[model samples]
Target chain A: MKPSSLLAPVLALAPASAMAGSISIDLPRLPVAEYHRPYVAIWIEGAGIQPRTVAVWYDADHRGDPGTKWLSDLRGWWRVAGRNIGTPPSGISGATRAPGHHTIPLPADLKPGAYTLKVEAARETGGRELVSVPFTLPRTGGKGAGNGAGGEIGAVAVTLP
Target chain B: MANFIMFKSLALLVGASALALPMTASAHRQWLLPVATTYSGEDPWASVDAAVSNDLFFPDHFPIQLAQIKVTAPDGTAGAIEHGITARHRSTFDVHLTQPGTWKIGTEGFNVMGSFKVDGVEKRVGRRPGPPPGAMGPGGAPAGTPGGAPGRAPVESVALDAIPANAADLKLTEAISRNEIFVTRGAPTTALFKPSGKGLEFDPLTHPDDLVANEPGKFRFLIDGQPAKGLKLTVIPGGKRYRDAEGGYDVTTDANGVATVKWTGAGMYWMTISATDNKPTTPRATERRMTYTATVEVMAP
Candidate 1:
């Protein structure tokens, strides 16, 4: 049998330090009229497997309208994971973030493999942008950063321990 | 060579449209343009505008009759439209997308038109007062007198048996058309895309709601649930009124009835496919004409 299959169960029981990682995303403040907090989605996409979502910042709760209405504006994430998982995906969906840098914790128990961290952000009456950082799992200490075109997203960095 | 092929296919499209609406001077294409294709949140609603116009998506001609539209929800249950109003240029309605999957809003029409000879004079049998239901009328109210409305004549559709048996030169043509658009509330589902095994239908390889700009969207065309080979599909992006050129392209289906369309940009696209054949389900009709049109939105990647 493959080594990954044998290590999968042990890694599931491992402590957070062994498998935990974090993704820092920067939302650029744009000089545009009628600005709304952008809906952001971060996920990991690997070959030959379903995309695993790490965090989704959206308007989960709003007065008079469900903030989730614009989740599809995150086009890349919607095509991969948003459309499959229903609105306000448990444990992953949260309130929209302001225009600044924020850190999101990665999900534990990700199998050892090559994956791409995708960060997509879309603003109402504005623009949408996606940034991706490719990296390999089970690393000692490494980091990768991707920069967007500055319409919605800014810099995205993924660090693994 | 590519330009020549495109011109030929466009000519064929115009010819098919002329055959479909024989009375119209200009070819009028029908479509259902949704306010948005994808939506979310609780109690989400989708509003759609229905029209048939000379220019794609421009409500310049007339409105589609609201009586013919049918909404099919994700669970295969019947959904009804709210506040259906037919104006002079376009008809509008709202759908409450209560279910969290893909919903189909469309209309299907079937009619027979032909001529017969009586006393050496040829008389048409299927010419109604105005255009057929679900088609563009001559800049007025919706056609077909289903409800008891004044100043409108009832649609005159003669049955095959109603025609005099002794009449000579009996020729009948069957016209079948479908116009559709897809909207998803939260998650996109395929339950509504299942073919009914009749008429011109779509058996999509790529989900209709998942199309992206500059990406190839694969779709299969079926006539009576069989592959419609060598068919021509014309795709025109919306907002033709603002552009200097029409900016449309034509693609032909392969032997498997599949056509891959790489959308040029981000926006809603109006696609149309029309074909004619000798095969007709109606017993007396000798030729069958089929037209399928869809309004799909392509998002930017």
Candidate 2:
């Protein structure tokens, strides 16, 4: 028997953390009249696999989670992926941020596959914007990245390494 | 923005004098006129006449900015439209229809504001209409005030001056208007009707480009992808400089969020609907409102 075949089963038994990597997203500022930090939802969606939410930037710090009610307003994300994420998210959620670049590391449980990184943002009294970056996760360990733009979001660059 | 206010105010003043209406009442109409609805060839060049008229159908005879217009292809791609030639009564854009499906041509987010500052407090001026039912009620106001009609979604712009701007409060009045058109060549496509996620949207059960004059059609109203009921709709015939008091048709959606309307004329048609949430959880304005407008060219039998 080939030794590589024997090692294939051993590799399958290893934890997914052995393939973990990090992604950084650069977000530029928008010049609008009434500017506010956007409620951003970043996640990975792929064919035949459950969506993995990397981070959700919203007004979670608000009292009683009043902002959560508007979560459904995100439409595409909420209907396709967000609702699946349970309430009181332990670590995947955070507060909104001012205009600038930010980074989010992938979870250890992420498996190697073809996935799309999606970022959707909605601001108060402002338009809603969505951008998607397609990427491939290598088996061992590597990197992939892409970029786009929107009215409410600018200079959207995603890097997985 | 400044030009929009002037044109709108001019129309309002003219309508107010003719109808003997209150200063708070605004009567501006937006219309789209196509050189022809149906073409015989594969590639057709069309000139569309666009304007913000007075009352129901009369031409406003004012200048309209071309930057306010947008066009959507049959494949659902939306983009800004320029290269318009402005005349005395209307502005026109030349559209080359190369696709074999429906195209949506329209304009939105046109707003006019009248503001006054007092005591460092910037107060809104004009009429503050109540919110639509099932959404937010009138912000900080009683349920049924004399400010506006029920079933009418409050304009995105509010007139805090309805309470009268005194020494303590600044007064302002804002009016917003939106317009659109649905035109098709061969098969009908739903790409142009995608929900913007910022306002009320029309989910057409019957193809807008397929509607024939005097034929019945069905439509559904949606907000955030959910069926919304009790929404009011207005439909008006195109290519007119004036209209009677009962010129347009008005109807409200049923429990299933369906509104049925039959055509009466063989011309371009304008349909509009609006929804508003007056009480927002955010710290900004007390109301959030959205208005949707669409134009469809109905074929003549």
Candidate of highest TM-score: 1
lDDT string for model 1 (B121-230, tens) is: 66566643343333432233333436423455454445566788777888988888878999998778899878888777888898888888978999999988899889
Deviating ranges (above 4 Å) for candidate 2 = A1-161, B1-26, B55-60, B78-83, B110-177, B239-246, B279-283
Summed over model 1, clashes come to 0
What is the clash count for each candidate, in the order shown? 0, 9
Clashing pairs in 1: none
Interface RMSD of 1: 1.6
Q: Cα deviation of A156 in candidate 1 (Å)? A: 1.3
lDDT of 2 at B105: 79
lDDT (Cα, tens digit) per residue for candidate 2, span B1-301: 5444344444444222212222121444556766655432335555677765654344565534566667777876664454588776778887776775677777655232334445654443433323322233323222233444556433333443343335343322223335667665544568776766544678888877566666777888877677778988877776445553445777788887788988887666777776665533233234545566676766543
TM-score of decoy 1: 0.82
- Model 2's CAPRI class is incorrect
Task: Give me the chain B TM-score of candidate 2.
Answer: 0.67
| Least well predicted 10-residue stretch by lDDT in candidate 1 chain A | A5-14
lDDT tens per residue, model 2, A31-142: 5667778888888898888777878887765675446645644545664566555342858888888877676666656567888878888787776767787767663353
